[model samples]
Target: LNAAPGWGTRLVAGAVVVTFMASYALFRDWERFGPLLLRHPTLLALDTLFGALLLVSAGPGSTLAYVSVCTPFLAGLIYGWRAAAVFASLQGLVLLLVHATLDNPHTGPAEALLLPGLCVVAGAAGSSLRQLMLRFTEATRALTEMRARLAVTEAVSAERARLAREMHDSVAKTLHGVALAADGLTRSAAAPDIDAARVRQQSGLVARSARRAAAESRELLADLRRESDPGHGTDVLAELAARTRDFHARTGLTATFRPTGGPAVPPVPPAVARQLLTIAAEAMENAHRHAGATRVEVLAGVHGGLLRISVHDDGRGLPPGTDLEQLRRTGHFGLIGMVERAASVGARIRVGRGTRTHGTEVRVDLPLAALTATTREA
Candidate 1:
């Protein structure tokens, strides 16, 4: 397309050359020479064609020098590097041929021959310059793409950090309170001269709080599990048994847990494990505190593709018309926490006045889907 300007310049130069020839013919012997060449048709044709070629080649001004330089640049713009080089060489050949038969004593044949070489050099330079520009443009585009990806990655990282902070503030605080309450109750139970009932109540409170703390602690850790290794070690059934043993050791409450079925580790998601443990702890605590119970039993197994966890205590049953809501509200963290955790994991948790052994019973039945096998393996 840049060749467009050079072509226009050549056309204007041709028109001016035509005007000059017209004026020169009027004042000189151009007519006499024109008739002499006509007697020889071949010579007349050659002379006329050479005059037209000269006019067309002489671009916008009398300076044919400027035209020689511009032709190659124009060729380079229109035909890239290789074609531009060929055009430059062709222009020199045309100029040499035109100068050969022309009688006008303007420039020498050697000068006409040098014009094409100059065009090739200029065209090559233009090609090199264009290549450099393209390379720089490509580099810029690549940098822009990299920067956009970097921004997206940073945004995701920041969002994860914010979520971690929120988890700490909400779940972490609640768990801490429960743990402190357990420690307080445990210390209270160690006092001397306390009645049996009072001692039992205090011990029960401690066990309940401890269990809630453990559950919450597990939950807090679950969110931090690796994406590639999304599993928590230790089976849920084994965890229940371990907690029961720990409770007995700590409070001398005689807590016992058994899995009724084959040694299949029932799938248990982290949320389900937390809730079931909390519920068991709450059930046993209520029996010991309010019912003066001596034995607590925890039964855990899988039934019909569901995880069943039930806690039964041989303590006195809950009082008639007991305000279960009020009981849950008055720092009975176990009941409320258990329910919340169960709901989170889509488990069906029930706490009622009586079950086997005529004591308070709490049971949680969770769907197999809610209890992930990956979590159990973890």
Candidate 2:
């Protein structure tokens, strides 16, 4: 079978042919028939025959006879070493016939055989070069596959780490608080001179804590299941509004959602959408459980190529000099987790005093370009 040679083989063949033609023109006078023999179609169709004829015309002792080496070299590159050897043998037989006819004084049998020997050497070198290129291409393909596999492993590891952090920040913390309240209630009940009012209050606190823990567990499980379900065709802003209403119903807090700047927010990938939802949930949770805010407003808008989402509560703002790093050091992982979630999706997060100066605002800003690119990839 005839295989197409690589560009490198073609380039070498071109250079050799150019040099051979130049040498032939310099060493010998060109006849009118030379033009016809050098035509593109004739050269392609009778490449080996042309080389054999030129060698016979030049004779064994001439400098131009060595240029015939290109015929076998090109054959090896295109059709392997066996085809090259056959071409070289044919040229050698033509040279033997020419030498026997001419019987030139300067050219012996050994001198005639030398030209074919050189052609054989050139052919073997071309075959070795083609083999080297094949090996290199195979190696490059293997390396690319290995890198793709490594990237997938890294992505899986990062996802697992994110899930572990989510569990620690939400359900685990809620259950720990419930356990502490239950223990306190048990000790109060064991007291011989129990104050009924204090015991009843402790019982109520334990029940509420247990219920909150159960709710937190359910929400976490729901988030985990949603990761695999790709049918989330609902707009993220609408979902955020629903979450605010649910928060108000469950906790009796006055939580509201308002859209500003534009009527719609551009769509984002599921991974980015999930992170944004979790960040908003954490912000509202912190306002309800820690800030003790009676009124909470969730604002979402697109402004100057940025998708901004902010949760503002008319509660006690963050303590003086408190930042994400300080919160992490003090074991308050809720806000830290929110920041991590924002960072995971290439968004920026901030927590500070609200516009009222007496409340807290947790805000996340994501680039519109990021949303568009993620949507296209999804």
Candidate 3:
């Protein structure tokens, strides 16, 4: 017998016992006792010693003698074939002993051997059932473990993608600017009539760009090591204004930051603010590198219970048929990252022509309720 059976195993055993009891009631002539055993089959099944006594009293030729076979079958289910064989043997010995004591002339050699044979067969059948149950249990456990492993793999892949987007947006963009400044410096040095003051200024711009790139790289590493949000306690509008100034300094393009409908941008969660800042910076970078724009403007404001941030440039607008799918095919993930960042904080992003219907505009709109809800969840 199992020392401690699980609920599943117990359920299987109970179902078997119920089936056996129903068969006994249908076939045997219990008369008065039939109703009692049928009413409480649990008593008959659980009390094995009492069942054995009933077998002894019923004698070898009695129909009730077949009920003794259930003992070995139950043994097989709980303790395997070896124990089933032992119980079957013990049941046979009890029947032979009862036959000798009673001296029933009608109980011949064939009758004595038939019931014992049936007991052995029942034990084998129960053992086979047990093996099937064990296999089912093992398969279920393996499937559950496999699903857990798959979930972990997916989580790791997502984290890697997030890190790639961070590198592309911050360190990679800054380094690209640094390269442009270095190239400018090299050309200025090679010029025969190089102005001394302009050369010094170009050299300073290159140095500043390099330092900024290094700082961004170090910050990325620090964020990884700390495993915490890097945007906590940051001023969103101030950072955007600073990035706009830096863009102008590096690219010598006219970049401006403006707050419309208010003197200051409305307060938002630090993490949401950080994502907005990054999105705006990416739009500026695109304008400088791809649009050939001379001027760029960043606008921020709260209107009608919505926070809206927009970047506009005076360069040629986005090419026709330029969508996220086409950008992905071309290995450009900056806009994809911006969309994902906006989605993370319950915002909607739109990329199209600027307010003046010239150049391009990237705008993000977020509901004030969503911002408050996200803050509460965090």
Global lDDT for candidate 2? Answer: 0.71
**Candidate 1 residue lDDT tens string, 1-378:** 112467776776666577557647833985776555335444423433453455445531235434555545544543468755765665655555555645557766566666656767777876776677788988985564344334323333443465478568765675676677667566666667546776567567657766765676575465445311335433678888888888788778888898975547544443335456777777766767777878888888878656788888777766676565876767666567777666555566787644464776788876554334334233
Residues 140-219, candidate 3: write the lDDT tens digits.
85664444334333333454467669889978988898888889888998999998898899889888888988988887
Which candidate comes out best when scored by lDDT?
Answer: 3
What are the runs in model 1 whose C-alpha is more than 4 Å off?
Answer: 1-163, 166-223, 226-228, 231-234, 328-333, 353-357, 373-378
Q: Residue 211 CA error for candidate 1 (Å)?
A: 26
* Candidate 2 lDDT, 1-378, residue by residue in tens: 011368645654564477567647733764654454434433523666765555555555555466667667755665667766776676666667767767468776687778778878888876777678778988885564344334333333465467779889877887788788878888888989888998888788878877887887787666555544434322778879999999999999999999876636875545567778889988999899999799999999897767899999998888898877888788999988887777666677888984666899998887666655433333
Error of 1 at 24 (Å): 99
- The C-alpha stretches of model 2 lying farther than 4 A from their native spots are 1-234
Which of candidates 1 and 2 reaches a greater TM-score? 2
Name the lDDT value of residue 122 in candidate 3. 83
Q: In candidate 2, list every pair of residues with a backbone clash.
A: none
By lDDT, the better pick of 1 and 2 is 2
Q: Please state the error at residue 294 of candidate 1 in Å.
A: 0.3
